[model samples]
Target: MNFFEQQDRARRNSGRLLILMVLAVLSLITLTSLALGVVWQLFGQSHSSLWLASDGAIGLLPSWRLVGVVSLAVIAVVLLGSVYKSLQLSRGGQAVAERLGGRLINLAPQSLEEQRLLNVVEEMALASGTPVPPVYVLDDAGINAFAAGLTPQDAVIGITRGAISLLSREELQGVIAHEFSHIFHGDMRLNTRLVAVLHGILLLGLIGGFLLRGSSRASSRSSRNNSAAAIIAVGGTLWLLGYAGTFFGSLIKAAVSRQREFLADASAVQFTRNPQGIAGALQKIGGNLYGSQLRAGHAAEFSHMYFAAGISRALDGMLATHPPLDERIRRVTPEWDGRYPHVASLSLVPADASADQRAVAQGWDQALAAGFSPASATAAIASIGEPSAAHLQQAHQLLDELHPALRQAAHHGSGAQALLYGLLLAPVAGLREQQMQLLQPLLNADLMSHLQALEQPLRQLPGNQRLTLLDLAMPALKQLGTEQAATLCAVMARLIRADGKVELLEWTLLRIVERNLAPSRRLSGHFHLLELADEVQVLLSFLARAGSILPEQAQAALAQAAVELPYTGLNLLPAAQCDLKALEAALKRLNQLQPLQKPRLLKAMARCIEHDGRIEVAEAELLRAVADLLDCPLPPLLNTTSAAQVG
Candidate 1:
């Protein structure tokens, strides 16, 4: 999915989450409110003569007041408990993202091929106009990969050592591309959200346990045994109810995430146009003794998000997020004998083999890739439309067919320019001498001192923190303006090229860095090739109208965009037609907006299209189509009624 679709998904999800949160809050409120309602009834009833047993009996007002005070205390306690639970869940999720991102992995870019994997990942980030995510090598025997992060800026792609050693470069490319697709789409955010929601759900059980233990202790020490017994019983009941919530929450968490894995697999195949890479990787997983299981302490908590099965032994279909390995393999390769491929057992190889040996290995792989007929491979794998099979084949073909030099070139030059920029800016080592010079002049002595203090810590930082550091530095870089920014990019490119015979990975990295700094440059390549409309009115009105559409309006808007941007093949209609629940949410957000503001919002979007003097026909058409669905009127592209008025 594109940025717009991802944003719409996020907006819808956020709205649903907010509603869930409100309901949870109300549920807590209702519990206390019910308790208060009981107190109020008791207070009102105490005024009647029937409440008093005798003249010596305690006055009813005192008992009513005592009851009211207890109700207030209950409300306060419950509210505080709810707030604490929310905060704890949020904290746990952030901690996970930060810790995962900040993790260090000792991966040597030993071979040109391994370096290329880094370059391609970096290149894709540039191509997509996002930062290069941190890369880590898992030194395990398993052949698996996974991407993790709360945001694109803070994401990480990790692969096992076995994967690197066993798979050909083409196969690795397909695997990495699959992981990158997860980064580009809305998967990261949803994954993080799942972590938080699951934590909250689980905490209910913890809370119940805590309260029950405390009440049990208090009851043992109390003089009034019956009253103490009553308190313990209530606490025990609440605890049991909370456990039920936890049970359902865990099921929901696993269910929601499982299907997305299949979609992610498809997206990977789409990005790389190769199936063999992923298929080979999966085949390797099935053949390996260690398999794809992770030994990390937090394995089960993150099971749903891992690239392969984390807990191999605990494989229940109901709880397992990943489908069975045989099923996955069969889906990718229908002609498969259920038996595993005959991969020789791995031996301890020298980390730095002779240059001649490396070249021979590389040559052997290249010859194999060249010799294999695409048609033969296609026959070996299932057709593309067969769930995962066709897509996996395409990815493999794309990876295998590309010349190593061209693969490297794709990492550098125009194809990978933006992603390179994002990566270059991501780390201190990537900063060009001139870019640093420009930056140094802008900061005051105190800030420079602060920078000096930070330098050591920054240098020691891991992938995610290093990216975060880049984000922190962005506002300062933005201060450099267009001309200076362009100059900085040129300097970065030269630095990357300084070693002579620039590698494709290096070029891709530079490109990604440039794009992150200048998002407006995203469609610039297309703009150069296409003729555009001279008037801004058409584009502006179209976007304005499209922005006002209901959730259900996405399909119509997408259909319109598809017609406008003919070649892009943006599956807008499918993307726009969200589930029914999403429609209600869109209506809610629309309802909250002031009528005047909605039009203004549309106009602002229109203005974005009209920033350049001319708008391409595709751009204008897409904007207007979206605007039309938003229930807004389209003004004339040009006034034809009166030339005098136009003048």
Candidate 2:
């Protein structure tokens, strides 16, 4: 499936998951009512019998009032647990990785293996035009990996130490590509929801376990045998019920996760176009002693999120989050032999990163030499969330071509702040000096020094690479603490307003940065094209003006783009109506577009840009920036002219 189809499917699956969870909850309530009723009848109230159907008899079924009270209690606990997890994860993918015993890979990694891994991830992100996600290392023997987050901006890739040490660079790329597929397919958001939903279901068992332990302690602490016996009975029943509820939850996870793994494996091959790369990784997993089994305490909680099954048990056939090892290999490599590669130990011969990394610069230069044809709107939209080998190669080239200092700066918090500051420094001497004077007191000495150091390089940086630099700095920028991030946002605003006007390119960059720094939690919404009239007008009109210089030209461009909008009576709004502030506000709402609706809207925007038949590199960047804010990751396949000519 393409990006749009996969997203739409994920949206539908979320609904299905909710329905299934509700069914499971209902089953638990019934089972709990019966079990609790028996407990009440057996010990607390001996007068009642064990059946509700007995004619005019007080059976095991408790009074409706008692059952209602118990049911409400269960619901309250479940909701509380679910909400707690949801809020915790709202802190984004980093929270999940940390919870799973993952240590974030420092931007300036010391080890060769870490550097290589970072390079691969950076190339992939650059190729896909996504922010380079922070990578985390789980100090586990398992050869497993996962992509976690509610959105791309906050997404992170996590890998076990074994995978990093055991797999070859190509094989690791295959594995990373598979996880990236999960991010692209909208699976990460679903996975986050699943974690929250299942946490609620499993909380009952945690409570039951706690109660059982408490009763045991009471039996020893106090010589009250009858009270202790009653406690044991209640605790044991709840424990048993909780186990049953967990089984239901596992089945739910298996149902939602199994098929997605297959799709991701397929997508990995599509991404690298290297079947053996992924197949080798799978074979190694099948033969390894630890395989993909994790030692993390919460491994079972995130079982469905792993690149492979992290917890293997007797009921694996029914509860397995991933497919059978041999089965996955066969799908990836149809002619695979029955015997798996025996990976008792890894031949991890360390190599210097500078000497071992691919010739990405050469390859990227080759691609540029060959020339890339500009894509139509449909083709550009299709490339969203789908990065090919060419895109990967180009990403490597782009990163390789970038200045080392600028790149190093992109990888750390202070350096990233300096890089952004340098980008916003006015081109004119007077404006540049004015902005500097304004920033002098606001920024720290260290930050000012970094900005001064990067000034010359930043000014000479290609316009195309400007946005790339911003995206590359995202993970580092995200490292800032709350107040620091707020201050950073304020400084960004001051720099933009230093000249008392907002340029199109600068405004777009500011929006992209701000949105990524504080992403929207919305996955999909019910807002249709017809319902979002004002938003549609603002966004389209803004694009129309950005791509057309004159009033008449903007009108004509707006009309050309309006064909793609599913609404009637759409017209070009006056410049005041679609000012930058209005455009930003409109984008915040358009972000809620349904998965299917986004493509049409993006295509319409593309139509407006190409209405003049050729796109300036700056205009193309603006189109991409707008699309990025809408949560549609547009690829870098537009014009390559060097200057920053927006219109």
Candidate 3:
């Protein structure tokens, strides 16, 4: 399945999860209410005579009001707990990582292992045209990893110390790709929901346990046998019901999680196109003593989010979030002999780091990318969430090609901000001076000097490569405090408008900067293509104008895109109506297009970009920006050649 199809499936799975949660809650309510009713009958009404009345018959039924009250209270508690947790995690994956006892690795990492890990992650992110996520390492001996967030913008990758120390660079890449697959396929959001839903179910047990403990202490003080016994009975029953509900919740999580693990493993193979890389990682995990287990107390809470089962508890065979290691290995490498490798800690520096760089540089000349042209719309749609070996190699080469100063700058906070300022400086001397003057007061002496020192190289950089620079800078930019990020956005906006016209690239860069500060949340996509005529018109109109100089040429482009749009009364919107401001608002509305509808719209946009018979640097940037703002990942691979064409 493509990203859209996978997303649709995730949505369906979420629906299934909701149904299961409702059923579990209903079961708890019934069982808890029934238990409480019996307890109430034995105490409030008849005491010793409740089980068998004085006449030797059973006591009266507990009042319906009591059952109703108990049920309502349970519902309230469950809903409150679920909502609270969902909101807590809504802050994004950073919160989840912190809770797992993860320490964020700085951009300028302290060791070879961390540097290697970050390199692999950056290459993957650029190749896939996804934002480079900040990575964190857990100080644990477990061989495991995970990707967590509601969307790619806020996603973070996490790996354990043992995995980083033990696995080869290739194997580590495989594992990281597996987690990226989760991000691409919409599983991160689903997994986050699972954590929240299960937390609610688990909360009931916590509340019950607290009540039971409090009641026991109260009973000790009261020295009243009858009242204490009744209170203890109620508390104990609630605890049992809550625990039973949590048991079912675990079952739900295991069922949903296991199937997705298989999909992710398969996707990792497709991403790297080397089954052995990931299979080898799995083999080592099996042979290692700690395996994939984590010592974190909350491991069980987020087990379903892990790349492997994070907890090895009793009944793990039934409750484990991941499939057995042997099964996973066999699936990835069908010819496996069913023997796991004997794992041992390896050198921190990868064997081929230097050799790989030389290989990428040499291989680039032979790549088919030099003669590349934009593919058809369907082909473009197929490339979404899928990156090939060639793309990976090119990503490697791109990193290698970056100026050392530029590359190093992107790895730190102030340096990254300086890079952004340097990229925004206009080529025209007057406008550039205007921008520099505008920046002089807002920026510190250090930041101003940094940008000025780096100006020539950044300005000399090709337009196609600027986005790659932005991708590299995102992780550090995300490290900015709220006030700092806000200040940067304000500065970026002034910089973009200082020239009296918003260049498409400038507008795009500013939008991207703002998004990285606080990534936009995705819509559930209930709206369809037919429902978004005005928004479609605005998009096609802007795209048409972006690629063509002539009115007739723009019209042709608009018509080509509109052919795929399948709507009535569509027109090439006036340039005044389709300005950057309007296009920005249009994209927000268009993002609501249904899962199936999104690909259709994206394909139509692809049609517009292809209508001119060629792609340009500015045009490619515009297309990429639209795709990104709409939450669709478009690989930079196709357009690596776009640079050679006009950039």
Against the true structure, candidate 3 has what lDDT?
A: 0.82
* Candidate 3 lDDT over residue span 1-647, tens digit each: 88889888888888888998999999988888777878877776532223567888776455567768888999998888889998999878998999999877758676667777888999999888888998999987778999999999999999998888888878988999899899988999988988887778778788878878888898888877777777678778877888888888888889888999999999899889899989988998888878888988787888899888888779888788889888999998989998877765443324334423332222222121222356623454676787766567777878887777788899889899999988889988888888999999999998998898888778667666789999999999999999999999988888888878788888888988898787767778788787888889999889988888898988888888877776755677788999988998999999887777788788778778878676666666677778888888887735545334323
Looking at model 3, the pairs that clash are none
Q: Over all chains combined, what TM-score does candidate 1 have?
A: 0.49
lDDT by residue (tens digit), candidate 1, 561-580? 33333133333322234322
TM-score, cand. 3 vs. native: 0.93
Query: 1-647 in candidate 2: lDDT tens per residue?
Result: 78878988999999998988888888888788777877777676743335546477644566687778788978887789899999999988999899998887757776777888888888788777788899999988768899999999999999988888778888888999999999989899999988898888788888888888998998988876877877788778778887788888888889889999999999999888799888998988888888988999988888899999999879988888888988999998989987877775544434435534544332222121222224434455777887777667667667887877788899888999999888888889989999999999999999999999998878777766877898889889988887888898889888998888989877877777787788866745668888888999998888888777798898888888788888767788988999998988898888888888988898888778777776666766787788888887776663333111211
Q: Which stretches of candidate 3 lie above 4 Å from their native place?
A: 45-60, 345-372, 376-378, 639-647
Which regions of candidate 2 deviate over 4 angstroms? Answer: 44-59, 221-224, 344-377, 638-647
- All candidates' TM-scores? 0.49, 0.93, 0.93
The alpha-carbon lDDT assigned to residue 489 of candidate 2 equals 83
With candidate 3 superimposed using the best TM-score fit, by how many Å does residue 84's alpha carbon deviate from the native?
2.2
